[model samples]
Target chain A: MCELMAMSANVPTDICFSFSGLMQRGGNTGPHKDGWGITFYEGKGCRSFKDPLPSAHSPIAQLVTDYPIKSETVICHIRQANSGNVSLVNTHPFIRPMWGKNWTYAHNGQLADFQSRLATKYHLPIGETDSEHAFCWILDQLLQRFDGDEPNSEDLFHYVIGLCKQINELGVFNLLLTDGDFLLVYCTNNLHWLTRRAPFGKASLIDAEMVVNFDQETTENDIVTVVATQPLTDDETWHKMQKGEGLLFCKGQLIYQSS
Target chain B: MCELMAMSANVPTDICFSFSGLMQRGGNTGPHKDGWGITFYEGKGCRSFKDPLPSAHSPIAQLVTDYPIKSETVICHIRQANSGNVSLVNTHPFIRPMWGKNWTYAHNGQLADFQSRLATKYHLPIGETDSEHAFCWILDQLLQRFDGDEPNSEDLFHYVIGLCKQINELGVFNLLLTDGDFLLVYCTNNLHWLTRRAPFGKASLIDAEMVVNFDQETTENDIVTVVATQPLTDDETWHKMQKGEGLLFCKGQLIYQSS
Candidate 1:
């Protein structure tokens, strides 16, 4: 399995710190070095960068480490590549458009059965991987349901969740997605969350040599939450998810929950 | 003050169903008629359309209703301008590129005490709104901290959250951001989330004349999450966030917690 990290906060925030720490794990501390990708939302749009190289050594990851792009929502992934070739298309954190909005996604698990069946529907795969094919198939199914018109987010979410359940029955399906307004997450393998508000404290990452004293940088009213496949930091308490748990986050808080 | 809809799902899904219902609220069911914007994340990029008109009347929004582009993540906003003049730059969702990645953001609240004290160390305002200024400042701080290099996601997230907490103390700050990798959300006013997993059901919007039966389009393993400032559907249960809450979502679930 790969690794995933996401954060929603009560104020504008950046994922650089945690990303840097996580990058170390992409290859240095972990084996998810096949590829990596990340997406950040500014307002109603998104910026994404991906590399087939391990996040630990990629120049792009380094740049992300130094440049802190602050936003209310963020998604990132490091891949082990069980079902996809190591190419740009095989990278995690895929992007697409639906309902006139930009949508971004990343996944951290394998879907062995997603190959042949996925190709039967949706657009062709731009890369040789089940991930992209699955993504395309999902979109294709969505288009089919809506008759080529964008469905509402509510409808789309339910449909997609249902699809995810079906996929999970075949294999692991941990995923992260966003539409520049909300963050949707599902975990069939590994995931965790840690929210910080008043009384923030210092945190240290387990995989990297870094420490952040949130109390020094935050106020009593600030609330920040982080989600990841594995805890990025050792000092912070991360909440583990049940195998089939998922959640939707907006404005730094959990709005929808499911198990 | 405005109606917003977003979805993150484990599968690619179109948002026509929710948009149809939300469109009625754009002018018929809600007051956020100043403008509307939506973005979808496809593979490794994004597609977005914006109109400086009410979603109910905008041709672009109508086109969105008619065209289905499926994506894993989606963000849509119907605006009621509180800051910045009514222009494209003043739209609810703003997009930018940082550290070689696309960033998307949207806001729903007003900043009261930010006009005068905006002369800070980093990013400056590209638009007249405090939101833009804050975005610029956050970028500046990130650049400064990393000396123009992209920091890791964890570091960036922590740094941005620090700045967000500081500025939010000065005024209202309810915002969304993404880099196509993670969804980071901060709330100072209002936000909600709804997530569905296996055994999905039918749902209808509370503010519009639309309904969707997810059973027809969904699989059994899908995990989908939706977040919004207000509930878009009337028939489905929506989760509300308490004041001063923030979170980070990845992989279709909440990974971080903040209160």
Candidate 2:
């Protein structure tokens, strides 16, 4: 399996420290290599980058460590070949537009016979991975249910959950999604999270030779949350998730849940 | 609730079309104007941008729209205040490092009476949101369990999942995490994904006034996956998750699962 990383902060914070460590795993510390990608949100805008090279040896990855771009929400991935070939087209983290919003998605699991069941009138896959094919299938179902119209939140949530159940039956379906308003995350295997509040302190990186003094970089009112496939530091404690749990994140905190 | 947007491709692919549509929801079509964030990963490097301003009116957002940065994995979030005050520090995505890799996180739910529960050895928070507190708490636990060492994959996975369950008891704990190798997602409420592969076609945005012709932008071997809080298009279907399900994504496809 590959790895995943995410962040939610109370202020515009840079991910240089954490990202540097993750880069090492692409081919150095761990064995993800295949490819890597990241996305940053700035105000109403977004800045993203991707490369087909192993993050551990990629020049692009170095730039990220040197830059200090800040954001409130972010998602990233490094690939380890599974169903698809080790090519640039088979990277993680995908994006689309739904209900007048740009919905982003990333997956880490296999769906048995996904292509056979996928059907969409408005969306189709551009790659060969079952992960992407599954995305198209879900979009097809949404269109069928809503009839090209935006449904209310309650209805939309129910519909998406129902669809998730069906897809899960085909295979694993852990996922993360957003449309610029709410963050929806679901786990079917392994995931972790860490939230910080007032009284920030010093923290060191577990992957690379780096460290950060939150006391110096943040204020007393800042609140930030970091999520990852594995704990990113040797000195930090990480929270894991149970199988078949879904929750939503809004405004730097969790708000809703279903299980 | 907030909104999230992500894309995982076989090769580096631009999220311009989907992002354009998602931008509308930051303040134009939705009320997630509290803040916005986006992270793009290229190889081992990442480029991210975020603002505490509404994405719809931010000049930075406009610039993002004009620039076509591409990546294999991307994560973005738009904010809507619920627990913490609307400040730049209270944005969606947060970052940290561990096990020689970078980790990014974003949440979409509110935890009741959530606060940092670290054992005083992990990094603390600078804000008051439960999200940040949770981040620190998780880090603290990981550090404690591993004895200041990065555990192996299986050990890390088991330990982290245990932590997630602990936090879930506090309230909702939906999350997205990445270390640039894989995308690990957990759902305790709402999360969805759609995968795309060969035989692609045009996809219209449900929130914005734009569309993308996948056939023109991708190859037959390309594989991509998208995760979202809600489907971003009006005519596409999105797969939803069960209350307790988690998945891992690697190489633009699913790899691990728990339900």
Candidate 3:
């Protein structure tokens, strides 16, 4: 299994503070050390950084923690190589452009024979990874149903959740997907999220010895939502999603939920 | 105009030496300071770093230079922004995955009314940039001609050159494109290339006060081909490509040329 992290904010915000905690889990506090990747979406533009090296000691990961690249949406993953080779292509937070948007996806849990159903026309997996194959399969289905055009937001959200439900039956399928606008999350076994807004106080990392006071870093009008496989901070109140639950978040607000 | 740089090597080689010189031209030694980006292909996997900030002052660019990410092929660009706004979406070295390969592209010149011909079926430009739209147009043509599959080398190369000639007639269209396997270069007005092998010597950078001895850095079996909009090194002899010329290079070998 791997670990996933995603963020959606009303304004462009950095993940340095939360990423510092996640990096420690890559090898220091957890056993996941295969590879790591992150994607930041600024408007319609997407920027990604990936390393085959373990994030616990990767110099690039260190740079990410030190530098702050603000974005409206972000997705990150640390791999453990349960399904694919520990290579650059297999690094997660894979991105493809669809509907004139940078669509990025990252998977946390394993899938059983996921590629068996991967019959694609427009999108193809660049690497031999179950996660990438699943991403492509999802995109292909969306394209076929919508015919190269995006549907209404509600229809798109509902259709995606239906697809996730179909995949979740195959195995554990916790995922985070975004197209530089909204974040879609589906939970099979484990997932948690938290939102920060006005009257913010302090939060401390569970995996690292660090603390950040949101009062000093964010304004009263700032709204930021962070979703992860597990709670990243020890003090924050993270709400755990139920199994087979689907969610959609945009501009740091939860707008839709599966029935 | 912007600047373009690309490399094809027999081995996984780092472009720190050449990139160091190019970054200086981003804002320090030249005026093309709108934005910059680079894509490095290691095997079939690709890692890219892009910034709307000027490369000369970008901390991400500094990390890229300080950390050596070796790759078999690389495409880089420093934008002067003649056709698009100075934003992250307009940064060069755009990428799209096709035929299970990450196709990366960078352009040095602007096209006049190029988007008018863009009638894409599979690929679409997410950003408002002439270079990206042209890239999508090229891919759409490739997909249409081959019926959703890559054509044979001879046919693909000839067809691409023919399409490039058509685009070149519109305006300046010097471009570097790759599918992580081979580097394709199309010259409209100006481009230069240099290949270095066993009998290497000292080379000095033109934009920065830096010198490197290839003898100490490379093995006798290493072969590297570097392409740029202008000569990047002062002491090396670079070959200038002719107008309307299309060249294909793979594993440091020039394999095809247009008639």
Candidate 4:
């Protein structure tokens, strides 16, 4: 129903090269043309740019492609508007403050009867999207369990995985969520990921006629991991996640994986 | 110290003319050169653009001046960074969600012994700024009083005014806060406002050499009020607010005032 992209890097890095290919799919090569949004995290500060217009034609989207905003974690989404009307309020990459950190979420699939099933109390959706409702529901669960205190990372990871599996049972629920420190991805139907370290090579876009040599852009010690609903590059070996699987990454390294 | 600017309009209006002048103060005209931020409200959705760079030289700030994003309410700040580091996390115009509405805040003056005076429980500051600490303190009071329930506008306005008075006792606290429906302003020392209605005339900027003819740009039914730390335009008749005064505005009209 939509497309999602996220990046985690050991150093501050820009997603311009991958975003260039994804922007083409917003309206030029694909049908997800309702709206688009992106969030970049710089330390504890998160900045988001959302437009209620197709990314392929949005001047702000063009600015994003032109400006290289370096961030340790980034999340982006292009919407097809399955649950909510095409508006600025319904744009993806929804964000809220949790545990003194800005948590960002983006969804790529539709859920059935989400509003009726998911109950939220502490956090509420500003928009009418089912995706946002689900996100609020997840946060509600977290608040109920942790009660404003920070939980251990492993325990929190497992708790989030259990929540993801329950949401996945309703329908397709591929999700990307991050809180500037860690990125957590859950797959229901489609998701792919790849990590680039030391031995980086050239890559070509699958949606656009663009090529980038990672060797020229990254240092040898730099680690960068990218996750998306679909592979953006044709040459890179993207590892496809199985349904009902969840993964957590911190500083570009996989820290937890659920079998 | 920082420069604060805000607008409340009956209809969606762009702040390009006033922003042009205020941005000049970020570096060229004044000394607030640490960072700058602005938030524009579109229905329940708010979009913010912030840069930890000087607004006079930032390309993002240049784009903000060039692009006319229409909004019914706007809050902006150009920071001098007396209490916090010059980073994105410490930029002005902080936002958080409370009672299902996004509340935006910006402060112009500093606070003394703020960390010791402010005790927060429900919300915490992600950045180390006296302004942000004051904001969290105010919100904490609100949460304690209302407990997630919506309060009557008049009662809420008075309660907020009392809170502002308490914070002002600690130090200088010129504030602008909004929740999409209303704009509340508190003046500790310096604040000015002007309202333009029917029979609008030409206005010129004080910091920048730009002139705008509102008579040709606005409709007769449009009512727009702008508030700033200093009058942005040299020729406009701005009413200076008294110290320890608070005002509430909705739909460009003054609804409540306290001595």
Candidate 5:
């Protein structure tokens, strides 16, 4: 299994505060130590960084925690490597271009026998990971079903939810996917999310001795949503998603929820 | 116009020495100050770093110069931004996955009326740049031509060279493309290359005051080839490529030349 993190905000926001806590779990306080990867969507351009080293000891991970590259959408993953070997190619948060948008995907759970089972021809996985195979498979279905014509947001989200249900039958398939505009999350096991708006207060990390006051960091009108496999902060009220649930977030607001 | 740099080595080698010279041309010594991007291929995995700011002034660029990330194949570009706005999406070294490989491309010359003239359906450009449009068109043709079956290296190189000739007819189209195995270079006006093997000597940069003694940095078996729009080193004897010519290199050795 792996750990996934994603953020969607009304304005360009940094993930340093939350990432600081998550990095501690990658070999320091938790067992997800195989590798780590992140993607920050700056407009239509996505900046991705990946390392095959444990995030707790990686210098590049430290740089990520130090440098605040603000973005409207972000996705991150820390891998424990059940389906693939510990290598740069197998590092999480895989990306591909779809409908002229850079689509990024990260998975938190393991799938069963996804290599030979996957049937994707349009988009192929560069790395041999069950998560990547599943992502390409999903894209293959989406592209083939639409046939290059992107549907409206609501229709696309509903189609994606149906696809997630299909993938969920394979095994645990908690995933976060985004294409700069909409962030779609689907979970089979455990996933949590929280929205921060007006009347924000201080929050403390569960893994690290760090505290951040949202009042000083964000304005009253700013809307931010964070989704993770587990809650990063102890004080924040995270809504735990039920099994086989799907969500769609557009600009930090949840617009669609699976019934 | 943009500046392009690429390297193919028999062993994993750092491009810090060559990049130091290229970084100066981004703003200090030349006029390509719009943006910069680089892709370093470590095995089947590629690590890419990009910034919309000038490479000479970007802290990320400074980190690239300071951190010696070794790679066997590298592609880099510094942009002056003629076709698109100065943003992250318009940065050079556009990448996409093809034939289960991350195919990266960097262009050094300009194209006239490529946006509307390009006819591509499968792969689309996330950024609005003539170079990226051309790249997507090329990939579309390749994928359609092969039909999911990757051709042999020689056959693929011949097809790519033919495609390059077609693209060169439009305008100046000097480009470097790679799939971590083959480094294909096509030139219309300006492109130069040099190979350094055993019995290496000291070389000085043309754009910067940095000098490197290659004899102290390599083993006797190492063979490295450096390609750029302009010769990066003053002392090295680079072979200037002819107009409408294409070359293919594999593991730092030139394997094919245009007929």
Candidate 6:
């Protein structure tokens, strides 16, 4: 199993405060130490940093925590390597171009017989990881359905939800996916989310001894939503998603949710 | 115009010495201050770091210079934007997945009437840059020529050379492209290459005050070749490539060249 974290914000915002807590769990407080990766989206372009080293002590991970890279959408993963070998190729938060937009995906749970369960066509897995194979499978499905042109947002959201449910049937398939504009999160087992808006307050980390007052760091109109496999803060209230549920967020606000 | 840098090595080697000099040219030594990016290949997986900020002052660039990430192949670019805006989407060293391999590209010159010259079908440019349009055009052509399976390396090399010649006709199109295993360099006007094998000696950077003794850093069996728009070092004797010429290098050895 792995740990996944994603963020969507109305304005370009940094995930340093939440990432600090997650970084501690990569090796210091938890066992997810195989590797780690993160992607930040600014407009149509997205940049990713991945290391085949423990996030808790990786120099690049430390740089990420110290540097505040502002982005509208962000995705991160810390791997424990359940299926694939521990290498740079197996690091999570995989990205591929689809419909002229770079789509990023990360998984937090393991799937049983993933290769046989998912049949990919247009997009193929570059890395020999079950998670990457599943991501490519999902992209291939979307490419088949939509072709080059994008479908309506609502229709695409429902289509993706159906795909998520089918993958959830295979096994524990918690997912975080985004294409720089919209962030779609699907929960089969463990996932939690929190939204901070105008009435933001101070928050303390659950894994690390760090605290940040949102009032001092954010403007009143700013809206930021963070999703993770587990709650990173102890003070902030996090809503746990039910199993087999899917949610879509755009510009930090929830746009769709599966009942 | 931008500055392009690429490396092909028989073994995993760090480009910290050359990258240090290139970092200075991003804003301090030269005028390529718009943005910068670099991709390092580790097996089938490749990780890239890009910033819209100037490389000279970018903290991410500082981390790249400080951290010695070893890779068999690397493609880097520092942009002095002419055809696109100074944003992350338009940053150089664009990447796309084709034939289940991550193909990375960086260009150093502008193309006139690129949109008309290149007609893309399968892949499209997400960023509004002539460079990216040209990259997608190249990929689309490859996809059309070959299906999912990879073609013969020699045939693919010749095909790519022909494509480079066609793009070079539009304008200056000095380029560096790679598919993790092979590095391809195309020169229209300014490009230089240097290969260091056994009996390695000291090399000094031209843009920065840095000296490295390959004798201490590399093994006797190591073969490393570096390609750049200009000679990155003052001490090493770099070979200047001829106009409308394309070279294919695999494992630091020249495998094919266009007459």
Tell me each candidate's RMSD, in Å, in order: 23.3, 20.2, 1.1, 1.1, 1.4, 0.9
The true-versus-predicted C-alpha distance at residue B148 of model 6, in Å, is 2.0
Ranked candidates (lDDT, high to low): 4, 6, 5, 3, 1, 2
Per-residue error for A59 in candidate 5, Å, reads 2.1
Query: What is the descending DockQ order?
Result: 6, 3, 5, 4, 2, 1
Query: Roughly what TM-score does model 4 have, to 2 decimal places?
Result: 0.98
- Where does candidate 1 stray beyond 4 Å? A119-123, A147-156, B1-259
Candidate 6 residue B122 C-alpha distance from true site, Å: 0.9
Model 1: how far residue B4 lies from native, Å? 35
Candidates, DockQ: 0.03, 0.05, 0.87, 0.71, 0.76, 0.88
Best by DockQ: 6
Which 10 residues in a row give candidate 3 chain B its minimum summed lDDT? B113-122
**The 10-residue segment with the lowest total lDDT in model 5 chain A:** A109-118
Q: What is the DockQ (computed on Cα atoms) for candidate 3?
A: 0.87
Better of 1 and 6 by TM-score: 6
Candidate 4: Cα lDDT at B156: 91
lDDT of 6 by residue, A81-120 (tens): 9888999988988888888898999998878788888988
Candidate 5: docking tier: medium
The TM-scores of all predictions, comma-separated, are 0.51, 0.51, 0.98, 0.98, 0.97, 0.99
TM-score of chain B of each: 0.90, 0.90, 0.97, 0.99, 0.98, 0.98
Model 1, residue A130: distance off in Å is: 1.4
Pairs that collide, model 3: none
**Compared with the true structure, what per-residue lDDT tens digits does model 1 show for residues B1-259?**
6666677777888888878877777777778788788877765556566666788887667767876667777778788877766655466566654554556777676676776655544233445677766776666576678874667766666666777687787787776777666677777778888887779899887766567888877898877888888777777788797656776665467766577
Can you write out model 4's per-residue Cα lDDT over A14-69, one digit (the tens) per residue? 99999999988899898889999999999999888888889998888888999999
* Model 3 quality (TM-score): 0.98
**TM-score of chain A for each candidate?**
0.92, 0.91, 0.98, 0.98, 0.98, 0.98
For model 4 chain B, the run of ten residues with the poorest summed lDDT: B94-103
